[model samples]
Target: MSKKHRREEDDEHPDESWLLPYSDLMTLLLALFIVLYAASSVNISKLEELSHAFDNAFSSGINILDKNALIKATDEQNKHQQQRHEDVGARPNKEQLKQEEQENLENLKKKLDSYIKQNGLSTQLQTQLNQSQLLITIRDNALFPSGSADVKPDAQKLAVAIGQMLQSYPDYEVIVSGHTDNEPINTQEFASNWELSSKRAINFMKILLQNPAFDPKKFSAIGYGEYRPVDTNNTAEGRAKNRRVEVSILRKYTDTATDDTVLDAIAAQDQKDASTASP
Candidate 1:
């Protein structure tokens, strides 16, 4: 009678094994809720503690990655985005491009002036801005020996720097001109001032063109030997001033002149150097 009663009780109760998975599912849901609450509250210590506990309790085959890794990835992404934004902001637009030529010329002048001042090259180098162009005059001795067209080794850096600056506005026409005092010359390499000046201009231009960023089509070389004198040839100082190499960055649209002629724009400097040596 007892056995029959026990079997009837089992039939009415059904199998209880199905409750194991349901209870496990409830535990997993509870763990998820705990994790979400801890994470939302920024309680990293508590969240790590709960994660470890739940991992041990429900050790099937699951793992939560370290929060630091996720945080690091997010930080890197933000930095990259910021850098891209800065680059875009720094780039010139069409309106800025139209005005950049003038602004770039002015900024280049300032940079050159700073370099000249820092290096104490005031006597050997100077810059002039006129209606037609931007003129950079370098004394012959700065880039060459007494009568040689070869550029001085140390002065190559200056050429490279000027080239770099000019590359910023590559569309402008650049003229490298060589000048000489009234003194005559006769050598195996150069027969007269014309040849000497021409070689000097060509060599310097070659150095300037060494910069790959510079467009070769925008460059030209001229030899104004004993013709265009910024100072008189009567005195030693005047002669020294007359011998020079001129790098002129020509304006793209000039109604009048092609060269950087000393117009009234830079007349004050001429007046200042009057009866004196000028670059």
Candidate 2:
């Protein structure tokens, strides 16, 4: 009975197991896993590159990049901008300076013209007006005796008059220049025209300095013997013209208009005074 029971139990357990569904399920799962793996692995490196590119594009302009290309480009742009700023900063305004210069020159011109006309020195002295400055020309004969560097007594009066006029505007500078003809001088006092001319300029300068209104710091003497002649040296008339002294009033940059408006105003006032006194 025990053997029979054991046989029956074994026979019952041995009932053919239905393993097809289980096997099929396991195979199908393996196939699905394989398909998933293949799809995921396809172009894995390319996908990673694209992701990094997208991140970079979105991150742009937030901060400066340390990459070689970005750094080089940024440096170039900065250099260009810096250069532009320097160019603009270096240029001074032009119109303002010109206007100031004109104004100052006009004032000097009016005063000089009036002096020449009033003293009946028009024949021996003249004033030239130009864009840059005013020049007062004095004939050599009127300033010194023949072959002498000393300023004549009459010349001293003229110098005093000029000094007084200059005192009214102490800000301007006075340039006394001496000019001579081609005639050579051989004397104990002056070996050549150069010496004579320079001495004459110095003498005139001294006379100007004697005046209380004259400032020595504002005066300078220059000698241009036989050079810078306004006329030809070959003729007597030209030589006479060439042998002269010129007192130039330099135009200040600030007095022209915007820069030199002060000078211009002075000049305009001098002109007005002359017109009022004219016959």
Candidate 3:
């Protein structure tokens, strides 16, 4: 009877049921710790390689990563790479624009020189290149009478030829500058060289604008009037050299930052001088 009772009690009690899930949870926790340790202690080069491989696997349009976390990392890396590529491509366009502008200016200078040689006007007109722009110089003796601002009838022919050649180019800002030797002027029409230089510049500009092809907005007349001399005024030949007009064509879009800064400073100083001028 006792043995029968013990058998019944054994049937009622079975093996523990919770052990399977508990052991599985322990195993998963152990695996997570191992992965974390491997990530923290791996060699840097190896880590980079792993990261790259992971990126390729996930974002290569072939999602190989079984876990979702690695795919997000790959997306971030892809976005970063795309941004870098875009940033790198941005500068070449600016460089190309600068190159095009430089080539265009050089061509303009060449044309000016060719025209000067062909016309046999080398005695009165000359072309040159400097850091700033292409300069086509016209001697005062060729363009105007002594102490007079009027451009001679003969000089108008020369201006027409220049205007025709310059019409081919419409990009540049043209500055027409009139300069005179350091000499005092006493005349019925004008008491100062400044007035004479300014009037001469205006008349020359008018001649140039007569062509109708050269834009008036692109042109400006400035009188240096014995200032900014290219040669010494001590000798008659040097003074003659200094008494001249220059047509300067600017050759840059955004490349003339330094030149523009210098010009701004000069303009400001000129304004100050005019304000302080005595009557």
Best prediction by lDDT: 1
Q: Is candidate 1 or candidate 2 better by lDDT?
A: 1
lDDT of 2 at 90: 86
Which lDDT tens digits does candidate 2 get at residues 1-279? 999999999988885566888896686577547545644754554344434543664577322223664465446656866887899888766667666667656776788789888889998998886544578899999999988988898999998887777666677778999988878889999988888889989999888788776678989999877656666666789789989998887766532344466567667765764443233
Ranking by TM-score: 3, 1, 2
| Most accurate candidate by TM-score | 3
**TM-scores for all predictions:** 0.58, 0.55, 0.60
Query: For model 1, what is the error of residue 131's alpha carbon versus the real structure, in angstroms, after optimal superposition?
Result: 0.8
CA displacement after TM-score superposition, residue 160 of candidate 3 (Å): 1.0
Instruction: Write the candidate numbers in order of decreasing lDDT.
Output: 1, 3, 2
lDDT tens readout by residue for model 1, 1-279? 999999999999999998999997887687578668756864454456555655654585543334664465456656866888899999877556646667777888888888899999999999987656789999999999999999999889989988887777788889999999988899998989999999999999999999988889999999978767777787889899889999999866543433334465456655654534333
* TM-score for candidate 2, residues paired by index: 0.55
C-alpha lDDT of residue 4 in model 2: 100
lDDT of 2 at 53: 40
Task: Score each candidate by Cα lDDT.
Answer: 0.81, 0.75, 0.78
Worst 10 residues of 3 by lDDT: 270-279
